[model samples]
Target: MLFTTPTFAEEKAAEKTEQYDPKGPILEHIADSHYWHMFGEHSLPLPVILYTNKGIEVFSSHVFEHGKEEYQGNYKYALIKDKIKPVTEAGEIDTTVRVWDFSITRNVASMWMGMAILLIIFLSVKGKYKTRAGKAPKGLQSFMEPLVLFVRDEVAIPNIGHKYKKYMPLLLTMFFFILISNLLGLIPFFPGGFNLTGNIAVTIVLATITLITVNFSGNKNYWKHIFLPHIPVWLYPIMIPVEIIGIISKPFALMIRLFANITAGHIIVLSLISLIFIFNSLWMSPVSVLFVVFMDTIELLVAFLQAFIFTMLTALFIGMAVEEHHAEAH
Candidate 1:
């Protein structure tokens, strides 16, 4: 039989005078003590969980538990205060979310960075256009004009053919958006701090857009080649399935490649910095910082490389779909 014991009157009085001290090593470790505002050595990978008093919480599994005792099975939350906390029923929190989660997230921070970069490029080109007084372009315009012409001449013209002008706007917009967003991800400060390109949702959306465009833009010849190829009759059945799967898989590959590469770079950089804290060695601090800085530099190049690769592959795929193969004369 289970018995619930009630405190004696004398024991209750003694307990009140003694005071119930909540402070302990476990509490100290779990408490939000560190000042994130101060840019210094004290940084901990505290697991941040979002919760509402109304019974909803979102958080990473990694930092939620401190030890075996702290493990609450699915009950991950540790009560910080008894008071009810107000939170959105669904959607992003503008405040109180952990910085790492914020950094990894795709949000307004990333959107603004992408917009700002595009604005700068367009304004600079426009400025040059005005100064030239209807003459040949110079400076920024000179640099950008060739790229614009190259996309028209090399990418759009060759792939989309004589009717390429119709699709030029979409192609150009996609290329520049991907390029600028990728580049912005490499920046470690304010506008660039958020890893927009690293997020799978963003990549998937972009890939889906490309997939839709490629299939929708296909000509009659494109569909004929995919459904009923010019190959052997016996091979058509097997080849048809493979070819259709390949068509779907290409854009999926694009989504994974971009997302993995960007996310991996950031994780690596963070891991390097985390080493110093893990070791708790003063000597290791400088080395870790230097290594992280070096990695950040490499990421800058990777940003541009990924953007170019994605754009080039897209052009290649479009080229394949639209390329006209004439029947050989007997």
Candidate 2:
């Protein structure tokens, strides 16, 4: 669920020996991409939606070979140093031209796919609730009912009080969206390798939404506490700024927490699996495989843990905002 950024140690090792740089491909797998990988050297193409001085230029990512090649559209573009850039007729990058990529990359596609899955699941469960009102929940209904109830009973009601109902839809949506996206990244194969939640862009959007929701839904008392604290008048100048920073800090923490947790899991799993190639020996396979199995089990737990932490923190923030009094929830 994270994009690869080369670490100082990795860069130093690369400089020492120009051989078997496993980190590059590992990072690419957990990164935003122009194609959906099916397997080795094969992938499904995504459309490049770019707007430039020439006009709206659209093309298939297949036209270029995994950033190793270039394509000519209204303007020529090459994937240079992991970025798509415009190039001159001589195949040199033309810094003068500006290219805006609004392309639907793999991560974007995975997000849409995850939402579609959620829609199907909830719609099916809703239909079941209507048809079998008093009966025991069956199949998919049985599976999802407990999770839905857990968030409401454990997260929302305990934190947000009676006003929990107003935010259930948003909370449920966030929880499942994150859970599913994290699970999708664990698949490591076709239709699932895209790292949606690990992407800072996606996490930032989620944090921003939570930020907006908290501030907007906050009551008069909330603002009063932030701007005019319980402290003395002389401390107002210092306290007010601190309180204000707290507001932004909550969401900032959320963004970093989710991104780091998810990305780290992917890196650890990939690094574990890479030991075999690094050794270049048949004997390393047994130890590497066993360790990888252990890591995968841990990652499975993390997939759910991250979702729970994110949702719980969100509920806690909302609780802090919408409470009318120091002791009261709502």
Candidate 3:
């Protein structure tokens, strides 16, 4: 009985010790860790791993300091322990259970969101077509019909010509898919949080498609102009190479512009929120949250703006590539 008197207090102390106790400063919750510390010392080559239960982690190829020297290797499951860990000499631990090197990680939650968006748009259009076959559109159709017609009349037809109606499907699909994904990324909650368009790899892939389409769709005149534009004979030597370089540079510029702009927007918003943690004050958090939310609202418009800009530029490039110039006899 005397020994049992102290047992309850000891058990309570043990329970407290076993509970999760963070030993260091808490991290600011950024939208996605993909672009965090993008150019800083701890910048990662891959996106950081986020676990529902375990929190943030990284698979780093870090150098571990041995007693005398350092060695480099993959630290597959390095748990992000504390605010910062000393560059361990024994090599970082690989704690990553699954790797997501691709820009789009197909998690259960993301897949459902993607599927939901797809279904909603498809059903909306299907229902509209069912009710109004040839009659004037109403409701969802009213809003979407103009955008569809605009892309066809203003973008595809004008750029690609009468013989190129077949290509409209791909162009329209690309435009809408990008626009939808960009808009979905603006939502803060569970169903629409993924930054599909902001991923650099996705932008690169889109640019590659545009590059391929432009070159493949080019007529003999297009290639001739690239290799030997109608310049003075003496100037051909200098100008030919420049023209070729320009052709290559166009798509490269598109890739970089989209990637940089999207990534920068996300980073700015994240940095604004991180300001609270930097100051370590509850008072600072409210101001930081307000500013970040305002920027996020602006980003909603930017998402559509970027999609429109990309599509417009793509149409312009196609127009230039497919144009037929008539020259009078000189």
TM-score of each: 0.63, 0.91, 0.65
Error of 1 at 194 (Å): 1.0
Residue pair clashes in candidate 1: none
Q: Clashes in candidate 2: how many?
A: 0
Compute the lDDT of residue 304 as modeled in candidate 2.
91
Cα lDDT tens digits for candidate 1, 226-314: 78787889998899998899888999999999888887787677566545544546698899889988987888888867776666667
**Global lDDT of each model?**
0.58, 0.83, 0.56
- The model with the greater lDDT, 1 or 2, is 2
Full-model lDDT, candidate 1? 0.58
Best by lDDT: 2
Cα error of candidate 2 at position 275, Å = 0.9
Q: What RMSD, rounded to one decimal, does every model reach?
A: 13.7, 4.1, 12.2
Q: Which is the better candidate, 1 or 3, if ranked by lDDT?
A: 1
Error of 3 at 136 (Å): 2.2
